[model samples]
Target: MRPLRIAVCVKPVPDPKESNRLQIDPATKTLVRKGIPLVINPLDRHALEAGIKLKEEAEGKVTVFSMAPPAAEQTLTETLAMGADEAVLLSDLRFAGGDTLATARVLAAGLKKMGEWDLIICGAESFDGGTAQVGPQLAVLLGIPWLTRVCQLKREDDNHLLVTVEDETEQRDLLAQLPLLITVDSAVNQPRRLSLLGILAARKRKVITFTADDLPVDLAGIGLNGSPTQTRDLFTHESTKKVELLTGSPQQVAIQLLDKLGLTEKGAGQ
Candidate 1:
C-alpha cells in the first residue's frame, strides 16, 4: 500500500510583544511584519503536531508548508527539526501584504505542485489576524471535503478516515475519506517539544523554496494591490468603569456577582 501523504500548513507570526505594536497605515492600508521577531503561529504549531502524530501512527510522510516572506524560511527550518519529512517555503515580494483570499490562492498553488496528497492540515486560526479563514478558504480552492476544529483523528484505511471535532455546542464525529482537509483547534494534542535528534535531522533536510513566479497565480487578485479588505484603525482602550471589590464569603460573592449580572437568587445559584 502507498504511504499516506500529508501536508501541514503553517505561518510565521511576530512575537506577541512585538506584534502588539503593529500599526496599519491608512494611506497604504497594508500590514508590515518588518522588524518583528517572527515565530511559528501558535495554532499552526498544534496543527503541525497533529500531522507529525498522524504520520507516526500510520507510517507516512509529513511535509510542512509556509506562506510568508522569504524570512519565513527560519520557521520552516525549525519545523523540519520538529520531525516533518520536508518543508516548503512559498515566499515572494509579490505575496507580501496578501489578504486571506490571496494568501490562500497562492498557498493552494504551491501545495498543488507537490503532487497528490491524502490529507491537508492547518491551524484553526492565525495569531496575527485571528481570521480563521485560510484553512477553510484553502479547502474551497482545493474543492475537497473539509472539517474544522478537529480534536482527534484515526486512519481507517487508504480511502477513509475518522475524526472527532468539538463544535460550538456539541461533539461532531466525522467519517471522512482521503483528499480531505482538516483544520485543527488547540484542543488537539499538545505539539511535541524540540529534541536533539530531531534538530539534527532538520539540519540535513532539504527545504524546497518557491516564489510567486514558480506557482500559477492571478497577478491582479494577489498581493497587497488585490486585497479587498482593509483595516480602518486600531488603538488601545482603557476601561472607564472602576472595579468594585466585593469582600465577602464565596456564597456572598457568588450572590453579588449574580446580582450584578441582573440574575435574581432564583435565577442564579441553586
Candidate 2:
C-alpha cells in the first residue's frame, strides 16, 4: 500500500498576551499588519502536532501551508522546527483585508499547487480570528468530506481512519474513509518542542513563498473586494460582576450564596 500524504494548514497570528488591539488604517478600513510581531496561531500548533504524529505512525510526508503577510515567514520556520517536512507561504498584498471566505479561496488554490495529498489537516480555529469556519468552508470548495473538533485518531485500515470527536452537544466516534479533511481540536495533543537539530535545519530551510499570481485564483474572490462580511464596530467590555460579602463561617457562606441564587436543593443551578 502507498504511504499517506498529509498537508496541514497553518496561520500566523499576533501574540494574544501582548495586545489584542487593532491597528487600523483610517482611510482604508483595513487592519495593518506592518511591524506586528507574528506567532503561530495557537490551535494550528495542535494540528501540526497531529500531522507529525500521524507521519511517525504511517511513515508519510507532512507538508505545512500558511497564508499571511510577508512577515509570516517566521511562522513557517517555527513549524519546520517542529518537524514538518516542507513549508509553503502564500503572501500577497492582493490577499489583504480578506475574511474567511477569501482566505479559503487562496488556500485551496495553493493546495492544488502543492501536489496531491491523501489527507489535509487544520486547527479548529485561528486564535486571532476564532471564526472556526475556514476549514469546513474550504472543504466545501474542494469537494471533500470534512470533520472538525477531532480529539483522537487511529488507523482503521490502509485507506480508512477512525476519529473520536466532540460535537455541539455530544461526543461522537466516527470511522472516516481516507482522502478526507480534518480539523484538530486544541485539546487533542500537546505539541512537541523543537529539537536542536530541527532548529538548525530550520535555519537553513527554504520556505516556498507564493503570491496571488502564482496560483490560478479568481482575483475577484481573493481580497477585500471578495469578502462579504465586514466589521461594523469594535470595542472592549468592562467587567460588571458585583462583589458581595457574607458574614458567616465557610459552610455558612456557601449556604448564603446558594440561598441568594435560590439553589438550596440539588440540581437547582441546572
Candidate 3:
C-alpha cells in the first residue's frame, strides 16, 4: 500500500498569556501584533498532533503549512520539531490583512501547488479571530468533503476513515473517504512536546516559503482589498463599579434596594 500523505494547517497567534498587552488598531480594527511573541494557536496544536499521530500509524509523511508573516517561520519550525517531515510558509506583503475567506483562498491555491494529499487537518478555529471559517472555506475552495469539531479518527483502510465528532447536543461517528479535510477540536488529543534531537534535526531542515507571485491567486481576491467584511468601530469598553451602603434595619435595607432597582412596584404587584 502507498504511504498516506497528510497536510496540517497551523496559525501563529499572539500568546494568550500576553492578552493584557494586546492592543487594537483604531484604523484597521485589528489587533496590533507588533513585538508580541507568537505561538501556535492552542487548538491548532491538537490538529498538528492528530496529523503526526496519523502519519506515525499509517507510515506516511506530514507537512505543516501556514499563512503568516515572515516572522512566523520560527513557529513553523516548531512544528518540524513536533514530527512534521516538512513545513511550508506562504508569506507576502500582499497577503497581509486578509480575512478568513481570503486566507482560505490563498491556502487552497498553495495546497494545490504543493501536491496531492489524502488528508488535511486544521484547528476548529483560530484563537485571535475565532471565526471557525477557514477550514470549511478551504474545503469549499478545494472542492473536497470536510468535517469540523472532530474528536477522534481511525483509519479503516487506505481510502476510508472513521471519524468521531462532537457538538453541543451529541457526539457521532462518521465514515468518510480520502482526499478529505477535517478541523479538530482541542479535546481530540494532547500535543507532544519537542525533544532536543527533534530540535537539532529541525535546524538542519529549511522551511519552504512561497510569495504571492509563486501561487496562482487572483490579486483582487487576496488581502484587505478582498475582504468583504469591514469593522466600522473598535474601542475598549470602560467598566465602572459603584458601591453603596444602606443604613437601616434589614427590612428597611431590603425595601431601599428594591426601590433603588425600581422593582418595588413589581414586587408589591406579585
Q: Evaluated with TM-score, which candidate comes out highest? A: 3
User: What is candidate 2's TM-score against the reference?
Assistant: 0.85
- Output the worst ten-in-a-row residue range by lDDT, candidate 3: 261-270
Q: For residues 1-270, write the lDDT of model 1, one tens digit per residue.
A: 447899999998887768677766555655565677888998889989988887888789999988887878889988999999999999888887788998999889888988778899999988878998999999999999888989887777778878898878999778898899999988888898989999998878978999878987787878888788655665445679997999799888888888888886675646
Extract clashing residue pairs from model 2. Answer: none
Q: What digit string (tens of lDDT, one per residue) describes model 3 on residues 54-133?
A: 88886898888999999999999999988899999999999987889899999988898999889999999999889999
In model 2, the worst 10-residue window by lDDT is: 261-270
Report backbone clashes per prediction: 0, 0, 0
TM-scores for all predictions = 0.84, 0.85, 0.89
Model 2 / residue 205 / CA error / Å: 3.5
Give the alpha carbon lDDT tens digit for every residue of 1-270 in model 2: 457899999998877665656566666655566666778888889999988888888789889998787888878988999999899999999998788999999899999888887889999998767889999988888888999999988777888889998987988999999889999997789989879998987776678999988997999998889998877754445689998889788877887878897887852443
Q: Model 2 off-target regions past 4 Å?
A: 20-36, 244-270
What candidate 1 gets wrong by more than 4 Å, as runs, is 17-36, 244-270
Clashing pairs in 3: none
Candidate 3 at 138: error in angstroms? 0.2
